[model samples]
Target: MSMPPVKKIVTWLLVIFLLYAIFTSPSDAANIVGSAWDVIANGVANIGRFFDSLIARS
Candidate 1:
């Protein structure tokens, strides 16, 4: 199946913006990535805790 034109355009735009940001200010880009990683990790940890609690209750 083919992706919609609008979705493709938006994806390309985001890619271009990310590349621009990375090249223009690498440190800032690194910080952004780090922050995003922390958020994702924390979210996963929270989900794991939720499941653990559910299992413990059973």
Candidate 2:
């Protein structure tokens, strides 16, 4: 199966924009990535805590 043309175009545009952002302002990019990582990590931690509480109740 192949991706639709519009989806492919949007993906390419996003890639180009990311590259431009990285090259134009690396510090801002780093901060953005760090923030994204923190969000993901906190989400995973919350999920883990939820399961822990579930198991503790059993």
lDDT of 1 by residue, 1-58 (tens): 9999999999999999999999999999999999999999999999999999999999
Best model number under TM-score:
2
Using all chains and alpha carbons, the TM-scores for the candidates as numbered come to 0.85, 0.95
In order of listing, the candidates' clash counts read 0, 0
Candidate 1: which stretches are off by over 4 Å?
Answer: none
As a whole number from 0 to 100, the lDDT of residue 30 in candidate 2 is 100
Show the lowest summed lDDT stretch of 10 residues, model 2: 1-10
Runs with alpha carbons beyond 4 Å of true place in candidate 2? none
Q: Assess the local accuracy of residue 50 in candidate 2 as a C-alpha lDDT between 0 and 100.
A: 100
Model 2 TM-score?
A: 0.95
